[model samples]
Target: MSAQFSLDNAQKDGNEPIWTVTQLNSRVGRLLEASFSRIWLRGEVSNFTQAASGHWYFSIKDERAAVRAVMFRGRAQAVGFVPRSGERFEFRVTVSLYEPRGDYQVQVDSMRRAGLGDLHEAFLRLKQKLEAEGLFDPERKRTPVQMPQRIGVVTSLAAAALRDVLTALQRRAPHVPVVVYPAPVQGADAPAALVEALQTAGQRAEVDTLLLVRGGGSLEDLWAFNDEALARAIAASPIPVICGVGHETDFTIADFVADLRAPTPTAAAELACRPRADCLQAVDAAFNALTLRQMRLLERASLRLDRARAGLVSPRQRLAQQAERLAALRQRLDQAAARSLERGVGRHATLAARLERCRPQVAQHQRRLTELGLSLQRTLEITLQQRRQKLAALTQMLEALGPNSVLERGYSLTRNAEGKIIKNGLDLKVGETLQIEFGRGSAQTQVLATHGLL
Candidate 1:
C-alpha cells in the first residue's frame, strides 16, 4: 500500500513542470516590469548607500510602508544631488524584482526633491511657451527711469518686501515722493491681486517708474509671480517697471517681462531713484564745468579785447607814424636815385674808355666795309637766283595740280548753279544750270539728263 501511494503521488507531481529559484524570480520581475511602466513615487529616503561601483542602493519609506530602490551608476550620475537619509524626494522608477534574491525592488531612473519636479516642469513649460511668443524678447523691454519723479511700489503693505523697499527709498532719496499700490504677494489670489494693482498704477500714470517687488522665498512660496497674467500685466504697464521678485538666484516670469530685474526689493528701489547726494554732486559737477567753460570763454574774449586795444592807435600818433614812414621812403628813394646816377656815370666812363681803346682806323674800316659790301652783293645775287629757281619749280607743280591741268587732259570741270564744283554725276539735276570749263574758258550749260555712276 505504501509503494502504491508513493507511485500515485509521483504521477500527480509529474503532471506539473517545476521551476528553479532563478527562473521564478526572473519571470516575476518581467511580469512586474510589464505591469507597471515607469512611475513617480514620493517618500523619505533611508539607508541611502553609494556603492564602490557608484551605484545607489536605498529604501524609500513613508509613515506606513517602504520599498527597496536601486539606481545604477549611469542613472545615479545624472541625478545631480546625492540622496541623504530622511530627505523626501520624488523618484521616477520602474518596478522589478531582484532575481538573485527574489527580493522586490524598484529601479530608479531619475529623482528630484519633493514638490519640485512638477512645479519645475510647469515652470519650464510656461517659460518655453512665452519665450516662443517673444514675450521675453530683449527688444520689447523698456529702459528704467534713472531718476523717477514719483516712484510707485506694488506689494503687500504688511509684507517685509514693502518695508525693505520703503526703507531703501527713504535712505537713498527722502525728498522723492513714494506711492504704494498694495497687493498680496503670496497665496492663491495673489497673482490676480498683483495684476489688478499693476493695472491700477498703470491707469493712474502718476508715477514715472513702477516697482514690482517681493522678498526672497522658496519657489512654491513665490509661485504667484510665475502666473501668465501677472507677467503680461507687467509687460503691458505704461510706466517702466523694475521687478525684484525674489533673491538673486530666484527668477520668475515677471522678472523676464519687466523693464529691469533687480536682485532684491531694496535693489529695485535703489535702481529707481539715484541718491540725493549723488544727484547734488552731479549737479554741482555740471555747474562747476559750466562755470569753468564760461570763465575760459571770457578769458578768451578778454584776451582778444586786450589784443585789439593794444593794436588801437590815436589819430595824432597814426599821422606821426605815417609822416615818419613817408620821410623814410623819401630818403630811400633819394638814395636809390643817387646809386642809379653813380652806376650810370660809371657805365658811361667804362664805355668811353672801351671806345678809346677800340678806336678804329678809318682807312682800314673803309676797306673792310667795301669788301663786306661786295660779299653781301654777291650773296644777294646768288640767293635771288636760287629763290627764282625754287619759285619756278613751285609754280610748275601748282600748274600741274591746277583745275586747268585736268581740263587740258581732256576732262572738263563742271560747276553747279550754286558755284560748287560737281565731282559726281549724282550732284547734277536735269533742270539745273551748269558752268562747264575747258582749259581755255568756261561756258554756261543746262543738264538735260543725269546718269548715276552706280
Candidate 2:
C-alpha cells in the first residue's frame, strides 16, 4: 500500500471527498508515527499475552488511561523478563494505529521492569568505577585459604544463607571452628551493619578465611552488598574473603572485590576449608611414607653395623699380630746387616788386592829419576852450546846493523832538540838545536839551514 494518499482523488457527487477505513487508519498511523519518534513510556502491564510466534501483546495503563502494545519476537527476546499483568514496566515504543481495526497501539522496541532499569544502571556504573580503580583486578585477588584454621561468617543469624554455610562447613570441615558475626543481609541499614561485621572480623584477626554471604534475592533486595563502602571494606580486609551473594547469575560489588567469589553460600563454606577426612588421609599417607623411609635407613645402618662387627678385632690379638710382624722384620733386618757386612769385607779385600797390584815402584822410580837427571844435564849442556853459538851470530849481525857500526863507517845520526833522530834534511828546522850522535859521543848543535836530498 502506498503511504501517499489523498481524499481529494476520489470524489462523491462533488459534495465532499471521503476516505475508506483502511485509508483513514493508514493516514492516521503515519501521522502518529511522524509526530513522535521512539519514546519511553512507563505504566503497569495489563492483559499480557504471548503468541506462538513469540510476539508479545500487552496493555499498559495508569490510573485513568490504558494503551495496547505489541513487541515482535526479535525485540521480546532481548527483554530479560516476561511481562506479567499488574507489573509496572518501561517500554521504548513507537505510536501507531492498527489499520484492520482502526485501533490505536504502540509497537514496543524494548522493555524492562520499571525501577530495575535504574538499579541496573547504577550497578553498571559502580562496576565500571570500581573496575577502573583496579578493585576487580585478577592480580590483586588473593587465593582462599585451602585449609583455614578457623572460618568466619558475616551474615544475619536468621538468614537462610547462614544456615546453608553452617551446614556446608559441618559436612566438609567439621574440625574447623566457625565464628559468626551477625549482620543484616538486606534493608536500608544492611550495608552499614555488613561493613561493621566485616571490620570486626578483620580486627579480631581470629580467622584466616571469612565468608560474606547472603541468600538470593532481587537487585533491590541485594543492593546492600553493592554499596561502595561495603565493597571497600571487603577489599581492605586482611583476611581472605569468599563472597557468596545471591544466586550464581547474581553479581554485586562485594563479589568483585572479594578474594574469591562463590556461586552460593554453601560453596563459600566449602571453599574456605578442606574436608577433615581428606586431611586425615593426607596425614596418614605422609606418616606411612616417613615410616617406610626410616625403615629403609635403619636397614642400611644395620648392614653397615654387621660389616663393621665382622671386621672388628680384639686389642690383644692386634698387638700379637704386630709383634709377629716386628719379629719377621727384625730377622730380615739382621740378615740384611750380615749380608751387607760380608759384601763390604769382600769389597775391601778386592780393593786392597787392586791397591797392591797398582802399587808404585818407588826405589826403581828413584833410580830412573837419577838417570833422567844426568840425561837432562847433558841435553841442557848441548842446548846451551847451540844457544850460545846462535847468540854470537845474532850479536855479530846486530853489531853490523847498529848505529855505532854506522858511525864507525864515517856516518852520523842527527837528532832534533826533541831527541827525535832526523833521517832527512826535511826533518831539520832552521834555527833549531840538534844533537849529532857518532860512535864515540853525541854532540848538541844548532842548524841555520836545511837542504833536501834527491
Candidate 3:
C-alpha cells in the first residue's frame, strides 16, 4: 500500500487527521496565497463599489467567467487607485481565502483601466493631486521655447518619432546639435524606461531643454507616458520639457505635465532646434538697420559740428557786433518817416479837387424823383373808382342765385322722410312721408298721390 492511512481504530489514533471544510480550505488557501502572493490579472471591471471603510469591492470578468476581488483600504489608499465600470483593467492581485468567511477570492494590490487603465488612471490621479498641490496651475506652467540653445530628445533609439524629429531638425534647424537619450518607447517596460531616461537627462547640466517625444500609437501603446511617476518626473524637472507624443488628438499625462505640448514629433523638433536660415536673415536685417542708423547718426553729428563752429565766436565780440547793427537800423527808420510825410500832403490836395466836380449831378437826380411822384397819385384814384362799381354788381348777382333768395320769392322746398330733396312728384310713393320748408314755418305730411304731371 502506497502511504495509505490506516482505518483501524487504534492504528490511526495520534496522526489521524480529519479535515473540516474550513480547515481544508484554510490549508489550500494558505498554499494558493503563498503561490500567488503577487499576480497580474486583466479583464473588464464590473460590480465595483467602495465601502464606508474606504475599501473596494469588485469583480474582474471576461465573457466566460469572473472572479471576486477586494482591495482593502490600506492597500487601496496606498495606491489610491480605482477602476470605472465596463472598462478593461489589469492589476497585481493575491489569491487567498478570506480567513473570516473562508470564501476564495483575489485581493487586489495595484490597478489600472482597460489596456490603458494603469497609465491613464495614474495620470488622472497625479493631475488632480498635483493640481491640488498647484503644480499644473497657469503660474506653474513654463513658457515655451522662443529660443533654445541645446535640444535634448528623450525617445527610443529605434523609433519613427526620432526619425521624424531628425528630419525636421535637418530641414528647419540644420546648425543646432541634437542629443538623444534612447528609451524603450513601447510595451510593458516602457513606463519605467521613460522615467529613468528623464532622470538621466535631468542630471546633465548641459541640456538647455528637454523634448520627450514618441511616435503615434493606440491608447495601450501610449500608456507609458500617462504614468503618474513619469508625470511627477516631468513636473519636478528643472529643464522644461516639450512633449510630442502620437498625433495632434492624442494626449498623455506627460503632455499636460510637460512645459509644452507639440502636436507632432517633427513640430517638437523644430521648436527645440534653432534654424540657421532664420538666424542668418535676422543677422542681415540687424546689420542693415545698424548701418543705416550709424550713417544717420554720423550725418547728424556733422550738422551739429557745423552749427557749433558757426556759433563759436567770442561772446563779447558778438555783443559789440549786435550794437553796431542796432545803430544802422535806427538811421534807416528816421529816413523812412520823412518820405511818408511828403506823400501824405500831396494825396490830400488831389482828394479836395475831385469832391468839387461831383456836386452838380446830385441836384439833377432830386428833380426827376419829384415829377414821377405826381403821376403816380392820379393812377391810384381811377383804379379805386373802378373796383367800387364791380363790387356793387357782384352783390346783386349773388342775391339772385342763393337758396334763401328763392325762398323769399314764395317757393317752398319739399323733402322725403329720408332727408332727400324731392325735385319731382314721380320720385314720391303714395302714403310715403314728406317734410316741407315754407317762408315762415315748416310742415310734415304724407304723400296723397303719386303723379308725374305738373
Indicate whether candidate 1 or candidate 2 has the larger TM-score: 2
State, as a TM-score between 0 and 1, how close model 2 is to the true structure: 0.50
**Pairs of colliding residues, candidate 2:** none
- By lDDT, highest first, what's the ranking? 2, 1, 3
Cα-based RMSD of the predictions, in order? 21.4, 20.2, 13.0
Candidate 3 has which clashing residue pairs, if any?
A: 88-114, 112-117, 112-118, 113-117
Please give the ranking of all candidate structures by TM-score, highest first, separated by commas.
2, 1, 3
The parts of candidate 1 lying over 4 Å away from their true place are 1-115, 300-454
Better of 1 and 3 by lDDT: 1
Residue 49 lDDT (model 1)? 90
Instruction: Give the total clashing residue pairs for model 3.
Output: 4
Tens-digit lDDT track of model 2 for 352-394 = 9999999999999999999999999999999999999999999
Candidate 3: worst-modelled 10 consecutive residues by lDDT = 1-10
